[model samples]
Target: MIVETDGYIDLIQYLTENLPVLSEQQGSKAGTSSYTLRECFEEQLSVQIMSVCQQNDLDQTMRIDIVREADAILYDFEEVLASVLDNHPTLEQEEFVTEFIGLIKNLFDARVKA
Candidate 1:
C-alpha cells in the first residue's frame, strides 16, 4: 500500500512537472488517490511497466530495460475511474471527485505535506 501511495505521489509529481496545462484543464485538485493502484498490481504481477513507459515516451534516449514500472498501474487507474465505479457499490461520485481534486492540489502545492 505504501509503494502504491508513493507511486501515485510520484506520478502526480511527474504530471505536475511535465503537464501543467493539462492538469489545470482537468480541474482535479488530491486525496485518497487510486492513481498508483495499478502500478502496485503490475509490480506484483509481471514486468510490463518498463516497456509501457518506454513505448509511450517521446525520448529517444529512453532505456529498453528501465526500472520504471507503472504502465499497468496507469491502465488500472483508468479502469477504476471508468468501469470500477459502475461495479462497486461503495464508491461514490463525490468521494472520487474530492480525492481527485485533492490529488491535484497536492501536486500544485509548493510545500509537500506529510
Candidate 2:
C-alpha cells in the first residue's frame, strides 16, 4: 500500500509538534543516568513513534507502508535527516534525525509483528 505524500507530511507535522514533550520525557526517564546523545535521541524517538502509532490507530501494515514510502522519497538516512532539518529549522537536527530513525524502526517493527 503506497502512502500518499500528504500522509508523510502529516506524520512529519505530528512529530514536529510533539518533539519538546518527547525530549522532556526522555530527560526525565534517564534521571541521573547519563546517556550518549545518540542513545537519548533514539529512546525519545521510539517513544514518540509508538505514541503516534497508537494515537492514530495505525495498524502494523499501515505503519510499515508509511515508513517505506517516506524512505523512498528521501532516498537515504542522511537525506532524510537533511530534509527534516531543512523543513523544520527550529528543531535540533540531531534530535530530529534521531526521532526520524525511531519512527522508521517502529514502523518496520509493526510490519515484523504482523
Candidate 3:
C-alpha cells in the first residue's frame, strides 16, 4: 500500500474511496470525509514527507514509512479496494485509473495474501 508519488493526492483518493467504514469505526469522521481525510493525511503525512523531499529537491525517491500510522491506513484501504474489485469484475481499468487500481491489486497480491 505504498503511496507511490509526491503530493499524496492519489493516496488520499485511494484511502477515501476504499475505507469509508474506517470512519464509522474510528468515530472521528477521519476516514469518512474525503476532505477531512485529505486535510489530515496531508497535514500529517504529506507535509512531513514533502518537507524532506523539498529539502533534498529530489524529483522522486523511495520514502518508506514516512508516517507510522500510514501502514495501517493503507492496509485498511487495500482490503476494501481488493474486496470491491473482486466482487466487481466489470470495473474498467484505464490509464488514469490504473495507477491507483494497479497499486491496490499489488497490495492485495503481496501484502494481504502474505
Best by lDDT: 2
lDDT of each: 0.36, 0.48, 0.39
- Tell me the TM-score of each prediction against the true structure: 0.23, 0.33, 0.24
The window of 10 residues in a row where model 1 has the poorest summed lDDT is 22-31
- TM for candidate 3 is 0.24
Models sorted by lDDT, best on top: 2, 3, 1
List candidate 1 stretches off by more than 4 Å: 1-76, 85-92, 111-114
- Count of clashes, each model: 10, 0, 0
Predicted candidate 3 versus true structure: per-residue lDDT over 1-114, tens digit per residue: 344533244655755664433333333332333333223332433444444444443333233433443565455444545443222111122122334434443433343233
Global local distance difference test of model 1:
0.36
**Per-residue lDDT over 25-76 for candidate 2, one digit per residue giving the tens place of the 0 to 100 score:** 2332333435443444445555655655666767688777655554464443
Rate residue 107 of model 1 by lDDT.
31
Show the lowest summed lDDT stretch of 10 residues, model 2. Answer: 82-91
Q: How well does candidate 2 match the true structure in TM-score terms? A: 0.33
Best by TM-score: 2
Provide the RMSD of all predictions against the true structure, rounded to 1 decimal: 13.4, 9.3, 14.1
